[model samples]
Target: MATYGDLRWGVHLMKRILFLMSDTGGGHRSAAEAISDALKIRYGEANMQIELVDVFRACHWPLNKMPEFYPWIVNKSARAWGWGYRLANMRPIYSLNKRMIYYGNRQRLHNIIQNHAADVVISVHSVITPPMMYAYQSLSQRPPFITVVTDLVSTPRYWYDPRVDFTFLPTQKAYERGLRRGLEPERMRVVGLPVHPRFSALRERATVRAEHGWDDGLPVVMMVAGMDGMGRLYHTARAIDAQNLNCRLAIITGKNAALKARLEAQTWNQPTDVYGFVRDMADKMTAADMLVTKAGPATISEAFIAGLPVILSDRIPGQEDGNVTHVVENGAGVYAPTPAQVAETVAAWLADDGAQLRQRKANARRLANPSAVWQVADAIWEYAHAAYIPAPKKSSRSARYRILKPEATPQR
Candidate 1:
């Protein structure tokens, strides 16, 4: 048996961890990255190796094209997307879907698993969870598998699997949903969503504003439409600018070149700055007094850590409906479904010297769990250490070796 001190002192070989995810939305990849960063920070990078794989992209034909179609489905028709989400969640439909996935890409998935050879496998995307679990069934030697739910309140049924060693949920509502989905109670934990550690670090607001050359006196409203810019961002920005309110605007058109160019070409009545795909979002959030954006789980989590009040501009119907309710019911934000409504809500929050806005900020702070990433990293470390089995050295011709093996089980 290897003790904690022995493992820490390099008595065992480095552990490899494979993080399974897809770019269907930015949240999944971002969650994987955050967890990877947290693990590296808590345990020295030299002690472990981490690899991120986009399982959907590695699949065949139509399945491999999901990342390309995701933005179109959400932006073109949210109703259609909602219908698909609901339909696929049904037991019959989901079972068929899982079978098709497994049969269609079994060889590719097996090759991926064999090549990676991880000591622990963690999945942050729901689409690949079942397929990956199915792939592990064929392996004689398999690693401990875990799932981390990135959604806040309402999670799809595909996110749960009874075979998973453990499930980490972002909210209590999600934990309850896991129970309803037939996951073991002892194997589930309710830790907040994994956000980048930078979000938790406190930065001086005025200093960040100064660095960005933003006005120190005027209230700044940071508007965003997610990483792909898949929302009615142009119309909302115009409506807010048309308000002629006593505030400044900072619009981030993430990866939307045309939108950024159009916004820059037009004249505004207020002090406005337009940017495209900014890397320093934490700094931008720190300089802003409030946030006006779509209901992305990662963005909401980051805003909470920054203690910034939010005005939700849009959401995917079935996937993000619970997020809107969670924010509004907790008094951290308001649901403004239209451009005009978003503008009106912003104006109201900016009234009376921002008394209402200050309260919302307080509520956001109260809801924040800045240490969530560390908590999740600690749990992963514990499980990974427990599951690790060091490789044995080759025996000489004159010598014989006896290796003891445990009985194989279907589930952990």
Candidate 2:
């Protein structure tokens, strides 16, 4: 009911902004938390309110309710989200999904909007976008529905309607892709990725390492790769020990207790620390000499935002190619194609020419738009209030990515 015109008087401490995130990837939750953190630091507790609802849990949707129903399909497919990442970025696949998902998620998004009474709603995942867009139809007054692309590349399916107030992108390519998808250039903001501001500030590496009880002078190699908690741990550990590299390694085995136990059993002569899951990634990043990670858009972007050099171990396919390009082109990181090659590259990176480090930092800084939250939050507020909310804009930046329609998939 109230539009930007109504907000001319400005908002007070009571105004509320709600964020919607998924449990699927650490990136989505991390992005939402980072924004919330920034808002709190800027406005303090009373001035801002944030609730991140997992849509699956918020509503007993069948597809979401029984994770076991399609266990093999679901888990395998999710792990294959990288293919989706690529498919979502490439061709007509990207464009069509935008419209399809937009319609499918309608009811759920409506319920979420109505229940939360959010002045503005932010979606960190694309699956929620379509539903959120349609949910607007059921409201007496819909809130501004904001979609933040949590990957290094822009998602075509996520940009179907220009009605969205703003689409936040991590890379220039993504911003351009959004424009090609029929978004107005003005509506596209090249705010790299939303990372905790703590990462933006330079932390004293020695202090962070000391607090973690790491050796005083060794190079700290932090692997940001996903853990299987199975055989992979020993292989990676053995590789490290055999290399006889002079570095302290820290491996984050996220949600993998088995891998943790297995790794603990190994008496690695090389100094190392293994963590299950860590909230203080920024600190760990600061303490590390160079990061070894998987090429997931969010992690890559976070590492980029932190200004730490990277060596991406596993490159998830599809859009991750673009994600990898962004980092490598900028000189902030290197992609190690072979598992064994990792140690050698680490050696080279430790002894890199001066300009390379400077360039990497420059590229990382260029990608980071640290003030993204204020801009995004403000845009959502403005759009949600308008009596006439626009339809989602087609992204123009996505023209190069338009793929053949699903109808054209060749029949075997």
Candidate 3:
């Protein structure tokens, strides 16, 4: 048995971790970075080497363009996206998709694993998980592999693979979904979605407001759609502004320069601040009394940590559908799809000196797992330490290039 002291001393041995993800959305990369940061925090940076690879970007032609095409796919028609999502979740279609992915990208994926030579591999994206696992199965000496489901509730079927050494679920709902999809109970853990550690270290609301030059006297309502500013943010802002509410507005038009410019060009009824993509979201959330945004898992998790009640203005179809229910049902927030509904929800929360808003804030805080990042880091570290083994001596060039046998291929 490896003693605790022995493991501590082994810290000098520099463990390598490979995080496999895609830029399909910001959440996957953000989750990878949060976990990577957590690992560095737990075991000093020198003790570990972490690399994030956009697996889809490294794949063959059409597959490689997935990251680039994702936004268009969602933006073009959410109903179409939802249809495809549901279609792919069918048992036969899912199996066929896995086979096609394995056959198409096995060699490239195998090359990725060989080149990276990691002690542990983690997948944060649903689309790449199955194919990556298939490639890992071909290796004679495979390390531990983990799947951290970034979706809060309605996780896609592609996210679950029984062969994975471990699966980290963001919520109990997600874990149940995995169980229904055949993931062993013991192999899956319901750890909350990992957000930046900064969210956990929120400062006093008034202090943060003071630092940001926001008025402490007025209630702050922060509105954000996403990094891409995908939803009806401008209209929603207009609706809220038209309400003539006493609260101040902090609108974050993230990476949407046009939207920011447009919002800035306008005259408002209230003390409103318009900002572009900001790095200090944690600070902004801390300063705000409430958050109005879409149902993105990462944003929701961050809001939970900040204890800010969310007023969901929009959500992507399929995967994000359940997130709305999770928030509203948990009493952390309400799902108001239309701009008028969002305005109404906001106005209602602001009533009675924000009595309802405070209750929602308490609920959000109760659902938060502020230490989730650290917990996930600790689990991954344990897996890495346990799975670490000395690399075998180099084989002949011909032997190294040998393909996986049919008998060794992974099954559905």
Candidate 4:
């Protein structure tokens, strides 16, 4: 059993961070990876150790299968998914499930936290927070726990837990939502969503387009269906092509092999490019004029970072609905739920030498927070070092703080 007092005063120890997340959506894992990347940039690999644990996978049978159910509900059982979301939105329902899941996987989760010996624990997914908190009860020396909400504005009530040391919110709406959920102002920060640091780098549109062998002069409309490619991608692309607009199409059919084959086989009316899974999304996004995609929080945030406007084609009923409103209300993009509307909006944006498109791009840039990853990482470091470690005590003789000698500190 150790506490902050166990550490020798004035000694800077290597910080070990454990990030709790699940694969329910790629955004949760992406948020964790973004913070990891920022930590690498800020502290270098030698000084920081980061471990990402899929909390759902670490849990018991039915509970562990929760992540797998996300795609099935969003794609196959949309109505049922909406119903479930509404049911779970109630605090009582969420608490019941949270308690069940926590008890069901208590031992395994406790072992994870104890084994990791983490200096700081960050929960990126809402479902993991309760379980992680439950595990913390078993430890005598508990680390600082942080919750970084992956959802944009429409976060579920289950996401907020007063036990957490701090909560990082992505939007002002999310911050306001936290307040309503009884979060103290001191316990939350309105830091924007975390994207890869590469998105923060300046890139020339023409240069990126040329590097990818895309047409530099023509407007490029990029459509992405997230990692699952679970949207009306084919119909939207078809509708856009039917309009005979003077724009090129680039489709990212993520892990959807059938969709990829079908799209590649068809003869498009405009110059088009098809990619299966792209690692360099930042470069691709930078080259594009506008993005046509589902209202995923990560995609929207990435688009903002790239200074590209969006055309939202679909949104999962409960959680993703706010993403659409955020984009449209902020003047960063338009919400076109159907293929026809998508085509019409694209046509209008491309009309009159892309006057409206340029305006949206400016707005997107205004909303972009590419440096958010660094901000979050720095905040984590500050909190962990300041509150989780013992401060130097002053000596009466000199009235100066004591400093530890190099040889006096022991390494783990």
Candidate 5:
């Protein structure tokens, strides 16, 4: 038998992990990628085979409306989307919607579960969890089903399903919410959200700034418009440039080609560099003194991991509100919803030898959960060794409270 530290070396057979995510938002895919990287780092690549399966695109048809409508509502009609989100949070509405989704994608769910023969099936999306648990119950013998909630604090009703063997939450708030939702305390572990391990492996800020040809003495403020670059990028950049705070700007206009072109064409008051979709995000983050972006859970978590303080410009309604609160309450950063506010916050932080700024940065680092990736990997490995059988359900249609404990419970 293989020891815990050296499973791959001892076993000839490789274990397969299937990560189920939908493209409704970028966070789920990012989380999947983080776990995949963590597995390779901890267990040799030869030992573990990780496959990221986009559940909605590959399996669930028609029910993929969430991904399709997400960008539309977020970009075109945010208020309407917010109203819809609030409506969805109501128990009857949420339950009805969930059932429709599961029934609509039932066959696809079954196919995904049976076809992959995954040693461990992990879900990072909220909507997919119950269906995944239902599908897992269908199998005569199955691998453990784990749910990793992507949200930091503001989790919705659909995020908690009782069928998962182990639930990994990112914050104490999430764990508390899980308990409120009736998830067993033992099954829920408050392992912070996994960021890409590279964020943890950041080079020194001064070295990175020098490499990027940035002035080492000037404050480096990074403005990110999220992966889609949906926010008011032009206005925010202009606001920061207007400030005479002796600062330089590193603007990450993620995947917004038109915006990138426009920003590059214009002359800036402050020393500025504009980038399209970035691959070396960690290095850029490392070179910065502060981050100005939306209240995306993944972005906030990644910035925390890089020890970069943030100024949240905006957030998706309902889901991302808690992320902003998490940052402000924890003193990791502040909430600045407008261009003027963002600039003011940046200018204020850049002054006084950055004494207050340094404190906030320290707070950000304190909230940093850089070890989350490895912690999650360890949990999965630990669970995989135990005897976990899919509990028999009284009714397939109604998901009851099922305890997913191992037959022989290991003492924590």
Candidate 6:
């Protein structure tokens, strides 16, 4: 019943939203932008303001591998480091990762809380939540903090504490995972993934095609590599091209100069587009018939709402693999292991719209919950009212954190 303007906390003036993000993988930051855009569009600029920031860019990141450009690193040290990251993601390392992330960013985050006083604070990164919550306890004036998880696979690391006012989930499986983890069911909301509002317009396929100057019959295939402007694009493109599939290809080769150069080198007679880093992804999603990429939760969720069938491919190990599993198991995308297989599936979809595409599209519709933004905005409004006191009582310190395991557990 809480509409956008219905706030007892005088938040009908819900003036601003601070979207905290990082430059880690493009998915996290991109998810933040998507939600903020939704708030601005639904609430109107006069009623709301949105600001996006990169916590990592504020300081700069030391080189991290695999998920953050470590394809070669995963190849080089297959056993030592990559295995460690994957294995740690299991139930054992959850508490240890939680502590390391908390104390590391504790002070700097305290400053962020002191400086920006929005009605609500939202984070796309799970790692940042523990630290932010620790700092939130110190401020005399703090806003409600919500963690919008960009990953579909819920791990113990993500459900760190009960301090978060709400945790937004991407899938039914993730919601169930949260319930199993003892997260407060009232505070846990399954709003699907926060997708850009542009994807929510629900335009007819013919209407979308006319805007792009494409024939109504031609299937539009959009290829995206997160915001880094990347993913096994060349090979993926080559695989698609080899089929001479009847679909038009729109390749989004995000900021990677080498990837862009390689894509430019290829010659194709079919209708094709090769661009680097587009500011309006919702427009791109609106214009496409299908999405092809590694199954980042943000991209998958966006595609799900737009009713675009997805070809899930090119995943890194650990969380990305988990996300892809959720998408496939939920029937949101076709599980394609190779570029050729992806092309074959695309051909089947185009050959008979009733074939694979039809089923996947149904799955996507079943999977999407477009109301997540309003839910988040609603929670933020609540945060404004509840955050009248800046700090938690010291006597209640133990209430802030949950001990996942015993103290004698070994640290890696």
Q: Can you list the residue pairs that collide in candidate 5?
A: none
lDDT of 5 by residue, 1-35 (tens): 11112123353445667888988878999899988
lDDT tens readout by residue for model 2, 1-412? 2212212223432345777766654667878888777767765656545678877555445536522332233335645765546666565775575556545554554456545655567888766676566556444335566778887763555543576777787767777777677888876787767777676675787788889987468877777554232113346555666777667888887767877777777776668888887778878877776777777776666666566677776564554567677778777788775557777776665555445555665666566665665565456545434433333344564233222212322221
Models ranked on TM-score: 3, 1, 5, 4, 6, 2
Per-residue lDDT of candidate 3, residues 1-412 (tens digit): 1111112225244577789999987899999999998899878887877889999888888989998787778777878988888899888999999889878987788778766766678999987899887776655556788999998998988999988889999999899988899999999998899988887788887888888889558899999988888888999999999999998999998889999999999999989999999989999999898999999999999999999999999888887999999999999999998999999998999999889999999999999998888888999898877643233333453245333322422221
Rank by lDDT, highest first. 3, 1, 4, 5, 6, 2
For model 1, what is the error of residue 369's alpha carbon versus the real structure, in angstroms, after optimal superposition? 1.5
2 or 6, greater by TM-score: 6
Candidate 3 similarity to native, TM-score: 0.91
lDDT for residue 103 in candidate 4, whole number 0-100: 79
Question: Each model's TM-score?
Answer: 0.91, 0.79, 0.91, 0.90, 0.90, 0.81
Stretches of candidate 4 exceeding 4 Å from the true structure: 1-12, 386-412
Q: Score each candidate by Cα lDDT.
A: 0.84, 0.63, 0.85, 0.83, 0.81, 0.67
Clash totals for all models, in order? 0, 39, 0, 0, 0, 3
Over the full model, what C-alpha lDDT does candidate 3 score relative to the true structure? 0.85
Task: Give the TM-score comparing model 4 with the true structure, all chains together.
Answer: 0.90
User: Which has the better TM-score: candidate 3, or candidate 6?
Assistant: 3
Give the 10-residue window scoring lowest on summed lDDT in candidate 5.
1-10
Query: Candidate 4 on 1-412: residue-level lDDT in tens?
Result: 2222333323557666788988987899889998998888887776766888888887889768878888888998777887888798798888898888877877787667555656778899987887677556444335688898889878988778887889999999889888999999999998899898889885787888899888558889999999878878999999999999888999999989999999999998889999998889999999999999999999999999898999999998887889988999999998898999999999999998889999999999999888888888998777555434332232353122122223433443
Error of 6 at 353 (Å): 6.4
lDDT of 6: 0.67
Candidate 1 lDDT, 300-401, residue by residue in tens: 988988988899999998999999988999999999989999999999999988999999999998878788888888888877766433332433521221
